[model samples]
Target: MGVTDEVLTEEHKIEIRRYFYNHQNADGGWGLHIEGHSVMFCTVLTYVSLRLLGESSADGDGAMRNARSWIIDRGGATFIPSWGKFWLSVLGVYEWDGNNPLLPELWLLPYILPIHPGHWNSARDQCAKEDLYFPHTRVHEILSSSLHNVVEPLLKKWPLSKLRDRALTMVMDHIHHEDTSTHYLCLGPLNKVLNMICCWVENPNSKAVKCHLARIKDYLWVAEDGMKMKGYNGTQLWDTAFSVQAIVASNLPNEYGRS
Candidate 1:
């Protein structure tokens, strides 16, 4: 976590690149999930990841070339969904200012408040058409416009800016608490990665960042295709319970089961 290139070992990087290549859609892009159709959201992110791993635009046996073509045909990374944009921005390829304000102050509100983070929708409704699950409502459009045009500018000024700083402190406190409580794995793969990023940003050499790095292997799974992040750390209790029930129903011999 201290340095970008040192995060993954050489072997780890090779397998990660293999996973992307093996899962590429016939159209030379990737899907939002495994075995799904290629979408801008997945395609652009995968392409950027390949580049970060030292693949040129021409690498991957023409796979990278075709991926670029797919993105170009769909208006490049500009149409990638907000999730992809966030990753790209963190990687320094996309402009952070291009994104709508995600007010950290929202985390400061009471849980009982309707404006609390649980229901907060700070970003605009923009996303690649392929990834759009629901159409944007008029109310959402108005809210996005208001935040982008009015609220964001005002928040940059005196008193409101101080509030943002305080809110950030509160957010980091929560993140650290969650990391220590969960032994640095957090809730799931997504939150684990997010929490790790926050820790790295806060202090790359801090104990929290080191603990997060130690727990990373918990999320990795090696399949026939390649290694990939599991949906969560593991469902050990759930899997064990079901497996025991099945073995009992089968009336497996005690010696055979024990063996």
Candidate 2:
């Protein structure tokens, strides 16, 4: 529903549109959660999602116009966080240069190295890449000088080139391994969408793309009001365990003792 090409069903699109329309705030924006204040991150993504799902920008009530004004007032999409930049890039709504580099090859570092993922205390630390922009320089210029930019131009300049093929192959293999290990769910909704885009860009016909499309259904949740994308697959197991503990703590087990 959110600009996913050929991967979303008609039912999904209808439900997603219903969810967005139902949740739009009085100010014509959205928030990070149902009860939260409107934020640029949530507002922009939801607005784009609705547009992609066939909603008109020129609707009579000025819903889309109001959301656009909100985004512009908040310094626009470029000011959105890294994850927002990533999704917008995939959707072709934002330039990839706006984002800090996210190199999958970072995982290829030797395990004994101090910078290896296993050596980091937090997952965030393990994935942190350089923030390459300076206050004076333009983002495009900074990105043009990046290693990815340098190598990408060379690859484009020479088709079928073998220069970085070996290293690039290793990175691609690691991506595939991750897709398999996580069953295409990845770490969360953002990561899942990014990985799907990566797989599609790399090889639309690859098994990885198929796996991602097949498993995406797990992240959707339907409710009486409407439907929405979930942070992850259902939390039934976690909720059930917590419920059992809470019940025990309430001393309700004695009142409802097993026969």
Candidate 3:
């Protein structure tokens, strides 16, 4: 039977999503499959995912609470990098200002604006980035006008609101699917907010919003470190590794030699 059939409860969704989030490294992101080192790839997408589910930046959890600070550091959503800016844009939260200078009038200027390498950093890094987690942006198209290697797919015709709607939808679907897949242990607080965001973004006045909002009760998690992502996950491997390295520097590695 599917996991959906076995435990499929709201509580379970909370669990898995939290795993993905707490396991996420700093920068407010998650690793791919929850096994890799953290990168902005997981951070930006997961941040939005959690918010949409039902968890708010105001959540008592450290990971969930620090989201906006992460986003605004690049300048209140105005100065986030291209892909980072896109995620914010897709959520309908980013401002049109500070966007790469997209002169629609250039289309009428009769000369295609040449995309110069001078403005971008590490195109390889940009290309390697996982678009699925980031979502597509119109700002990218405005600058390049070519999709030769765009990280994420562009919404048909590049309609801002439509693309925004779709991005919002994907996160919501993820929350439902996450809950169904994990029996509602909670897909981490991020997914909780992701579920909340989906309903709010798509149909703010619908029952889904109310339901997600109410589900907030299940998302609260308490920890010795002043409330954090629930069941944050295994740290023995990482912590032990650090401890060993520290002992080695102190010439204590020989102590284990006797064993």
At residue 83, give the lDDT of candidate 2: 85
The predicted structure with the larger TM-score, 1 or 2, is 1
Model 2 misplacement above 4 A: 1-7, 103-224, 228-259
Instruction: State the TM-score for model 1.
Output: 0.53
lDDT of 3 at 78: 49
Better of 2 and 3 by lDDT: 2
Residue-wise C-alpha lDDT for candidate 3, range 1-259, written one tens digit per residue: 1334343355545654565565655665455654676455456676766665557777736777566666555454444458777667766778656467665565555343464324343353354345557645778645554444452455444565587677767867776676556444454566656666765677789766666555554545644322334432335667889988888899998888844
TM-score of each: 0.53, 0.47, 0.32
Estimate candidate 1's alpha-carbon lDDT, on a 0 to 1 scale: 0.86
Ranking by TM-score: 1, 2, 3
Per-prediction backbone clash count: 0, 0, 43
Off by over 4 Å in 3: 1-16, 26-28, 31-41, 58-61, 66-79, 109-259
lDDT tens readout by residue for model 2, 54-136 = 78887526888988888888888787778888999998989878889867787898877876656542332122236533333
Q: Each candidate: what lDDT?
A: 0.86, 0.77, 0.58
